[model samples]
Target chain A: MELLKQSIRQRGIALSEQVLKVDAFLNHQIDPLLMQAIGREFAARFREDGITKIVTIEASGIAPAVMTGLELGVPVIFARKHQSLTLTDNLLVASVYSFTKQVESTIAISTTHLSAHDRVLIIDDFLANGKAAKGLISIIQQAGASIAGLGIVIEKSFQQGRAELEEMGFRIESLARVISLKDGQITFLD
Target chain B: MELLKQSIRQRGIALSEQVLKVDAFLNHQIDPLLMQAIGREFAARFREDGITKIVTIEASGIAPAVMTGLELGVPVIFARKHQSLTLTDNLLVASVYSFTKQVESTIAISTTHLSAHDRVLIIDDFLANGKAAKGLISIIQQAGASIAGLGIVIEKSFQQGRAELEEMGFRIESLARVISLKDGQITFLD
Candidate 1:
């Protein structure tokens, strides 16, 4: 978490009051070593939760989720943003609105991947509006799988994502919690 | 490589003569241990190529690329299929045509991540027509970066992808090469 926060402070760019760009190491470009550390941290936090699988959305979430899956010794299933031709049937689908992109896209996972007997851990790169995290939770619920917890790499604590998930009784663990990105300054939650 | 081949034999599904779905372990649902082994293999293959960075397309490719990047102790960058609000200027873009999806989409990478002095190794989940690989190659070229080689997790040898890249004089290493997927039988090149 210290390494991640340090990376954010050093390499993260505050584009505006509400936007922080970490393309250098977290989003567009990735630091594998940091991702591995993140994985270890998440695994350590939720190791005793009886997690059978790790779930995340496609694109940015895949790296952290895959690393965590490795550390947890579990398989990772990424919900697809773009529906593939082969993955049409038996899907656990949810519509997620991205506040950054300002568009609503459907995220789906094959029902064959998740089962009622499994305990799932949800992971992602950023949590702002809680829309994506909520969508993953919806899919997990649809499969009748139990929720292990939510693991986030970077959380915009100024936003309503964390409060909303916590209100829903989901245990959330974020490695880097950004309290504010105001006036071109990045502040952590400490 | 034998482990990968064995996985394909056991879990891979031949939907048609042209489409082989390994979603059980490669695309939709991922096996992390297998991915770690894949990373070690890719790193071992390209360890001496002087790889300064690992480049891959988003989603599925991120897992393997991140693993390989971890092994090589280098940073990994994934091209974005969907444009982000913050990633608007100073971009290296290429249009990729997905044969399976029958659609063409633009993939872009920020100029800040790639540079002329860097030696990049391209990693992807699958190589069929090689359009995605070619697009990454174009972006790397635009950045004035020299390519070390191409590392693919699975390659359809019967398709024109491998031949096309080889004709273009790019070094390619595929862990699992499928020579045929005819009559529901999965045959390897070996």
Candidate 2:
């Protein structure tokens, strides 16, 4: 977490009071070493939870989810943002509003990938309004799978995402929690 | 490669004469152990190439590219499929026609991530018509970076993807090459 926090402090750019761009290391352009460390940290945090799989959304979440899946010795299933020709009709779908893209997109998972037998740990790059996490939870519930927990790389605590997820009885663990982004300065919740 | 071939034989589904689905282990629901082997295989193939970075497209390609980056001890940068708020004006963009999605999406890389001094190794999940690879190549060229090579997990040799990339003077290493997918059976070039 120290490494991640330091990396954020060094490389993260505050685009505005509400936006932090970490495309330098986390999402768009990734430092694989940092990504691997992040994965190991997640595994250490949730190692005893009996997690059977790692679930994530498309694009940004795949890297951390894949790395965490490798560390946890589990399979990873990422919900696709759109339907592809190869995907089957048996699916669990949820609509998520993206604050970044400013659009509502449907995320879906194949019913074949998840079931009552799966205990899933949902992972993602960032949690702001928690809409994506809620959508992932919906798809996981539709599969009749139990939630192991939610692991986030970064959490915008200034927003109500953590509180909302916590109120829903979901166990949330974020590596870096940003308390506020006031006047282009990021405050971390120690 | 034998392990990959066996996985394809056991889990891969031939939906038609042209489509082979390995979603059970490769893309949708990913097996982390097999995925690690894939990364190691790619690393081995391109180990001598002095790869400074691993380049890939968004969504599906991130996992393998991340793993390869970890193995190669390099950074991994995935091109964004859409313009987001966090992205800057400095970018190298290319339009790719997706055979699966039946759409043309522009993939862009931040110019900050690539430069003329870097050697890029492009990684992807599947190679069919090679449109994605060509798009990536265009982005790399735009960055003025030297290409180390292209590593593909599966190549549908029945398609003209390989021939086209090879004609363009790009070195391609595919873990498994399918000679044909005829009568709902897959034939490997090996």
Candidate 3:
């Protein structure tokens, strides 16, 4: 977690008062060694929980999900923004809006993948509005699976998504939680 | 490679005479252990190339790319498909027509990541028309980076993509090269 915080301080760009760009090492470009370490940390934290699957929504979350799956020795299932021509699943779909992209996309999982047998852990790169996490949780619920927890790489604590989820009894785990980014300064939740 | 072949034979569905659906393991719901094996095989094939960075396009390509990067001990940079309001990088964007999705999308990469000092290996899930690979190659070329090779998880041998690239003197390393899928039977090039 210290490495993540240090990386945030060293390489994370505070673009606006609200947006933090970690393109150098996290979002666009990935540091595999660091990802392995982070995945190991997650495994250490949630070793007691029987995590049958590590689920995430695609584009950026695949790397960390893969890393965690590798360490945890579980499968990683990434929900798709668009149903591919090949995708033939007909079970559940959730409409989630990305504040950054400002577009509502549907994230769907195959019924063949997740089922009542899974104790899922949802992971992602950024947790801003928590729409993506909510979508994943909904999919797991549709499959009659239990959510072990929600693991996030970077979380914006100023957002209401986490608090709302906590109110619903959803466990949230974040490596680095950003408290405030006012005046080009970052404050951690500690 | 044997493990991958066995997985495909067991879980891969034949959609048509030319389509192979491997979503259960390779694409949609991914098996991390199988991905590690595929990555190790790719590493074994390109281990002598001194790959500086692993390049891949987003949505589905991120899985194999991360695994390949894990094997090579290099950073994986996935091209962004959907442009966001928060993305401020003056990027190198390539317009690619996806025959599968039946839509044209722009894949972009920040110029800072790929440079003349880097040797890039483009990795992707499938190779049908090779437009995605070419888009990635163009991005690398724009950054003045050298192309080590292209790694593909599955390749439809009937497609003109590989021949087109081979005509340009570029080599593609595909794990499973489908020779033909005649009457619901799958055949391999090897």
Candidate 4:
């Protein structure tokens, strides 16, 4: 976690008071060493939750989920996002609103990948407004799977994401939580 | 490679004669153990290429790139794809035509992540017409970086992808090469 925080400080850029661009090391381009460490941290936090699978959304979330699945020795399933919501009998689907892109996309997973007998851990790169996490949770529930826990890499604590998940009675763990980005400075939640 | 071939034989689904879906273990629902094995196999094959970074496009490419980066002790940078092309001074961008989706998406990477000093090895899940690989190659050339090589999990030999890359004079290593998908049966090239 310390390594991640340090990497964020050194390489991450705060474009505005609210937008932090970690595209240098976190999302767009990734540091695999830091990612592996982040995965280990998540595994240590949620290893006892009986996680049979690690679930995440496509694109940004796949890297960390792959590493975590490797560390936890579980399979990783990523829900694919589509432009429009498509209902299918063989898939579990959910809609997510992207505040950045200002568009709503539907994400779905195959029913065969998740089941009532499995325990699932949801992981992602960023959690702002908690929309993506909520969508993933819905797909997991649709599969009749048990929620092990939610793991996040960088969280915008200033946003209501954490509060929303906590209000829903879900355990959330994040490697780096940004409390504020006031005056283009990142303040971590101690 | 044998393990991968066996997985394809057992879990891969042939939807029609043109599409083979390995979502059960490759793209959508990923087997972490198999991914790690894939990374190791890629690392072993390209170990002497002096690969400074592992590069790929977003979504499906991130998993294998992550594993390969971990195995090679390098960083992985995935080019983010956007619906409409965004041309920026700070980014190296290229347009990739997806034959499956019948859409052209623009992929870009930050110029800071890639440079003339870097030797980048491109990795991906599937190689069909090689449009994605060519796009990544364009980005890398734009960054003034050298191509280490290209590593693919599965290559559709029936398509013109390999020919395209070969025409461009790039070395490509595919773990499993499918000669044909005739009659819902996958025929691998020896």
Best by lDDT: 1
Error of 3 at B13 (Å): 0.6
Give candidate 2 misplaced runs (Cα > 4 Å).
Answer: none
Instruction: Put down candidate 2 lDDT per residue, A96-183, tens digits, no spaces.
Output: 9999999999999999889899999999999999999999999999999999889999999989998999999999999999988878
Report per-prediction Cα RMSD to one decimal.
0.8, 0.9, 1.3, 2.3
Query: What's the lDDT for residue A80 in model 3?
Result: 86
Model 2 global lDDT (CA atoms, 0 to 1) = 0.92
Ranking by lDDT: 1, 2, 4, 3
**Alpha carbon deviation, residue B90, candidate 1 (Å):** 0.7
Model 2, position A82: C-alpha lDDT score: 78
DockQ of each: 0.84, 0.88, 0.77, 0.56
TM-score for each predicted model, relative to the true structure: 0.99, 0.99, 0.97, 0.95
Q: Per-candidate interface C-alpha RMSD?
A: 0.9, 0.8, 1.3, 4.1
The candidate with the higher lDDT, 1 or 2, is: 1
Chain A of candidate 3 gets a TM-score of: 0.97
Rank ordering of all candidates by TM-score, starting from the highest: 1, 2, 3, 4
Q: B1-190 in candidate 1: lDDT tens per residue?
A: 9999999999999888998888899899999999999999999999998999999998889999999999999999999989897786599999999876778999999999899999999999999999999999999999999999999999999999999999999999999999999999999999
- DockQ winner, 1 or 2: 2
Q: Please give the clash total of every predicted structure, in order.
A: 0, 0, 0, 0
Clashes of 2: 0
How much is A66 displaced in model 3, in angstroms?
A: 1.1
Residue-wise lDDT of candidate 4 within B94-144, one digit each (tens)? 998876666778888888788999999999999988899999999999999
